[model samples]
Target: MQTLRTDVAIIGAGTAGLSAYRAAKAEGASAIIIEGGAYGTTCARVGCMPSKLLIAAAEAAHAVSLAPRFGVLPHGMEIDGKAVMARVRSERDRFVGFVVDGVHALPEADRLVGHARFIDDGLLQVGEHTRLHAKSVVIATGSTPVVPDALSGLGERLIVNDDVFAWQDLPRSVAVVGSGVIGLELGQALARLGVRVTLYGGSHGSVGPLTDPKLIDEAHRLFGEELHFETQGRVVSATRTDEGVTLRYARADGTHSESTFDYVLAAAGRRPDVANLGLANTSLELDAHGVPRFAADTLQAGTAPVFMAGDANGVFPVLHEAADEGRAAGRNAARFPHVEPVARRAPLAIVFGDPQIAMIGKHHRELTQGTFVTGAVSFEDQGRSRVMLKNHGLGHVYVDRATRRFVGAEWLGPAAEHIGHLLAWSLQMGLSVDDMLAMPFYHPVVEEGLRTALRDAASQLDRKG
Candidate 1:
C-alpha cells in the first residue's frame, strides 16, 4: 500500500523506454523506469550488438579462410569456436556492465528491477509490494520472440535469436524457422562460420520496410542455404529427439515433410510485451495482435495523457526507431497541453544480411499520387565493391517525380548500413534530387553511388517535364 508519485512513469528500461525517461527528464519532469528483467536491451544484450559482433567475427574468419583463394595466406586459418564464444561473452559483459552503471548514474531517473502491472488508470504495482502513481505513463516494454503453437514442449533445443549467443559449443547445423531480418542475418552468420544452415519460410515476399524481393533472393543464393523460399511450407510441429530436434512442416499443396537438425531456431517474429500491463483497466486501445495502438505522430494512446512507445506503440520496433519514437512520445506526453503534433517522415529499416539491405521511406506500392522514379546501380559498378570482390547486390533510390524529393533509397552491399544514414537524412530533410546529388561524397566509396542515383532520379524529372 506504499504510494509513490512521479510526473512520468516508464514501464521499460530497454532502448525505447530508457530514451523516453531521459526525454521526460530533459523537460524537467520526474520519472521512474521499471524494468522487468536486466537493464541494457535486446540490442545491447542479445539482438543487434551481439548478433552483429558474432556476424563480424564470422565474416572475419571467412575472410581469413578465403585468403588462400585470394593468394594472400598470412599464417593459417583455424576457428576455435570456444575462443569466438569467449570473446562474444566477454564483449557482451563489458558492454552491458557499462550500460548498467550508466543507467544507475542517471540522477533524474530511478530504477526498479521487477515486473509491473497497472492497478488502476494512473496507479502501477511493481514486484510484491511497491506501488507508484504518475500523471502520465509510457509503455516501451518492447517485444518478445514468438514461439509458434506448433512447437510447444520443444524448448531448450528449439531456440530463438536470444539463444544463439548462449551457446558454449557451436552446432554443426541449424534450421532457421523464418527468413525475416533476424533469421536471415543469424543464418548467414552461422553459414559463414561453416555451420550448415537451412532457412524455411512460408512466403518469399518481403516483410520489412526494405521491401525488395531481389535482395532476399540474393541472401538465399549467397549463403548456399537450403531455402524453402517462395513456398507454402510452414512449420507444423517440433519434437525433441535423442540427438536434436525434428521439425514437421506442411507445404501449401498439403504435402508434409520433416527435417532434423542440431537446433531449430524460431525467428518467425516478435510480439509486443504487453501481457500484464493492465490494459483492461484503461481506455487505451489494442490492435489485433494485442498490442497497444497509438497515434503515430504523438505516440499517444488516443486516451490523452497516456502514451506508448517502442514495440508497444508498434511504430517500427527497431532499437533506433524505438529510441526516436520514445523521445517524441515523452515530449508530447509532458507538453500535450501546449504542443501540436507535426508530420514526421517515415522510418528506415536496415537489415544486416550477407549483402546488407538498407531501405527508407515509401515503396513503389505505397505511393498514392506522387509519380515514382527509381535508379539502380549494381555493386559490381562500384570501385570499393570490386576491391573487396563483393560484386553482388545493388544500390537503388526512389524519388517523387513532381517535387523531385527523395522518397526512398535501398542498398544491398558492404556499406548498406552506412548508406542508410544518407537515405535517412534525405528523407528527414525532404531533400530534393538536386540537393542530394550536390553532396560531396568521397569517390571510390559506396556513397558515391548515392550521388549517381540521385542524379539519375533527377534526370527522370527532366524527361517527364
Candidate 2:
C-alpha cells in the first residue's frame, strides 16, 4: 500500500472540512482533504442552496396569487412545475460547481478522492491502496437524512431532500412527515405552488422547536390556513399502490387514520454520517446516535489528536455554527499542545416559512416568568405590516428583571429573519432592553414592531424594580 504523511488530514470535503483545511494551511501546516462523494458542500449541493431556490420559486408563485389583495390584477396566473424545477436545478448546479471548482484548484497531492477509515490513532487508510499518517485529524463527514425503517417499504413513493430538487415535475399531492424546519418550509412552499400538502407533527404540535407555546399555537393557526396540519399524526405503516402511497397513522387519542398521496416526504430529521469512519480504532467513544463525544468549545474528542466539527458532532446543524466549529477545531488541531478553547456563539435558529419563525439565545422554556420580563407587539395592526399586507403575526422579547439585560427573543412575523439577526447581535454584545429601545426606530417599517416590544420589556423591568 502507498504511504503518505501530512501535518493535518481532513475527512470529508464539505463546508466544515474545507474550512478546516484552509485554517490548517493558514497555520503553516501541510494538510490534505479526502472526500468520497461530491466535492460541493451539503449546503451548496442539497440542503440550503437548492432548498432556497425552490422556496424562491414558490414565493414568486405565491406573490402572484396574492396580488389580488393589493388590487393588482393579473390574468391567467399559471405554474409550470417542470420549468420551475428545471430552473432550481440549473441554479443549484451552478452554485455546487463553484465549490467543486475551488476544491479542484487545490494542489493535486492535497486532494484525495476516497473514503477514509481510521486504522489507529492519527493514522487513516484511504480507499483500498493508500495509508496516511498525520499529526492531527478533523472529521467533518456531515450527515444524511433519516428515513424510518417503517417507511422503507414504500420504495420510489418516498422522497427526501436529496432527491426532491431533482424531480422532473412536482407531485400532485404530498404528505410531509415532520413539522420541523425542513418539513414546514417545503410543505408550505409546495402548497403555495398549488400542490395539495398535508403536514404531520406527531403529538407535540410544535413547529421548529419554538419554545413559546403561544408562538407554536400562532404558527399552527397561520400555517394551517395554507396547508393541512395533522398534529396528532404518528405514522404506523406505509404501503405503495399503483396510484401512489398510502399512509396509516395513529392519532394522539389512539385513533387511526389513513391517507394516500402522490408522494411522501420523510423530513423527519438527519443523522451524522460518522458510522463508516472506523472511529472504534481511536480512543473516542461514540454515543447511541453514532456521534463522537467532543468538547463544545474546543471541538476535540477526548484527549486524542482527533477533533470533530459540523454535523459530525451532532451538536448544532446550522451552517454558520458548522463553519465556526470547523475554524476552532482546525486551529486547535494545528496548535496541539498549545490548544485553547474558543468562545461559542449565542444560539440562533430560523425556520423560513411564511411569517418566518425564529429563536435567538435563551428560549421561553428556559426562563421563569417571575425572573424575566417580557414585551410583545402584534403585527395585526403594525403600520409597516398593514402597508405591506403582511399584518398577521406576533413578536415577543425577554429581558432579565433585575439587570434589564436582553436575554432572548422569539417572533412569528413578517421579516423575522432580519429581526432575529438584530436581536442576536444585540444579545451577543450584552445590550440591555433600554439600550435596544434607544436605537432609532424608522417609521412605517417592520422593525418598529421590535421597538414596541423592547419598550414594553423596559416598562416591565421598571415595574419589577
Candidate 3:
C-alpha cells in the first residue's frame, strides 16, 4: 500500500471542493482533491454551466419567436434542437476545461480521479491500497438528483436535468415533475424552445416548499406552464409506452391521475452524495437529517480537524455560498486562517423562472423590536421596462423604520440577477434605506427600480410616522 501525506484532503471536485482547495493553498497548506468521477462533478458536467447555457439558447429562441408579436415580420422561426444541444454542449465542455485548468494551476494542490473512502478516522483509502492522510479533511461531495425508484424503473424513457443537455431531439410534449430550482429552470428553458411542456409541481403550488408561497402563484400566471400541483404527491410511479413515459401520481385529495408525454424530466430535488465515502466506519457525527453535523463557522466534525462544506454541510447549496463556506472551512483547518469563525451573513437567492425572483436577509416575521416597512415598484412603472419590453415583474424592499436599515430586498423582473447583487452588497454591508436612496442609479436602467423602491420605502416611513 502506498501512503501519501498532505496538510488537507478534499473530497469532490465541484464548486465547493475547488474553492476549498484554493483557499487551503492560499493559507500555505498542501491539499489534494479526490473526485470519484470525471474531474468536474454536477456543476461542470450538468448543473450550473451546461444548464445555464441551454437556458440562454432558449431565451434567444424565445426572442426570435416573439419578434412577430412586436410588429417585426422576422424571418422563418425554427429551432433545430439537435444543433442547439451540440453547440451548447461544446461550449459547456470548453468552459469546464477552463475551470479545471484554473483549479489545477494552484501551486500546492493536486487533483486525483478515483473513489476515496475513509479506512479510519484520519485516513482515506483510495481504490484498494493507496492511503491518504491529512491533518484536516473536507467532504464537499455535493448532491445528486433524486429519482424515485418506481419512476426510475422507466429508465431511459425518463430524463433528469443531468441528461437533458445530451438529448439530441426535442420532445413534442414533456412533463416536468417537481417545482424546485432544477425543475423550474429547465422547464422554462424547454418550454421557450417550443416543447409542449407540462410542469407537475406535486405540491399544490408551482413553487416548492423552500420558496415563498406568494411567488408560487405568480410563477403559474407568467410562465404559462401548465401545472398539476397537489398535496401528498409522494411515491410517484411512471411507465414507458410506445409514445413515451406516462406518469401517475396520487395526492391528498385521494385522486389518482396520469399524464402521458414524449418525455418526462424528474426534478424531484437532491440528496447529499456521501454513500461510498465509508462514513459509517468513522465516529464522525451526522444529524437526524443524515447530513454531517458541524458548527456553522468552523465546520469541524466533532473535535476532529475534519470539516464539511457545500451540500455536505447543510447550508444553502448555492455555488457562491458554497465557495464562501469552502473558504471558511479551508481557513479553519489552517494555522494563519482569515477571520476567526463567524456565522455566515444573510445569503442571496436568485431563482430564474419567467419572472425571476431574488431575495436577501430576514423576512418580516423574523423581525423583533424594529418596525417593519416595505415598498414595491412594478416593472410596468419603469421607463426602462417599456424600452426593454419586460412588463411582468417588480422590486420590493423591507426596512427597519427606526434605524432605516434594510432587512430584506426582493426583485421579480428582467435583469433581476444583475440587480440582486446590489441588494446583497447593501444588505451585507448594513446599508440603510436612506443610504440606498441617496445613491444615483442611472436613469433608463433596471437599477432605477431599486431607486424607486427606496423612495417608496422612505415615503412609507413618513406615512407611518
The top-ranked prediction according to TM-score is 2
TM-score list, all predictions = 0.91, 0.97, 0.91
Model 2, span 1-465: residue lDDT tens:
899999899999988898898888999999999998878999999889988889999999888888899999988688999999999899999999999999999999998989899998889999998999999999999998888776888878898888888888888999899888889989998998889999988667678768797888888889888888887558998899987988888878888888899999998888889889988887787777767787877888878788898988778898999888888778888888567776578788887888898799899999987888789988999998999888988888999988889999889999999999999999999999888888888887999999989989888777767
Better of 1 and 2 by TM-score: 2
TM-score of 2: 0.97
Q: Per-residue error at 140 for model 1, in Å?
A: 1.4
Deviation from truth (RMSD, Å), model 1: 2.7
| All-Cα superposition RMSD per candidate | 2.7, 1.3, 2.9
What candidate 1 gets wrong by more than 4 Å, as runs, is 74-76, 107-109, 207-209, 214-220, 223-232, 251-257, 336-346, 368-370
Q: Residue 249 CA error for candidate 1 (Å)?
A: 3.4
Cα lDDT tens digits, model 1, 142-219, are: 888988777778777789888888788678888887777888788777877777777776544343344555654555
Identify the superior model by lDDT, candidate 2 or candidate 3.
2
- Residue 50's lDDT within candidate 3 is 85
Which parts of model 2 are misplaced by more than 4 Å?
A: none
Q: How does candidate 1 fare on TM-score?
A: 0.91
Model 3 residue 217 lDDT score: 54
User: Worst ten-residue run, lDDT, model 3?
Assistant: 225-234
Candidate 2 residue pairs that clash: none
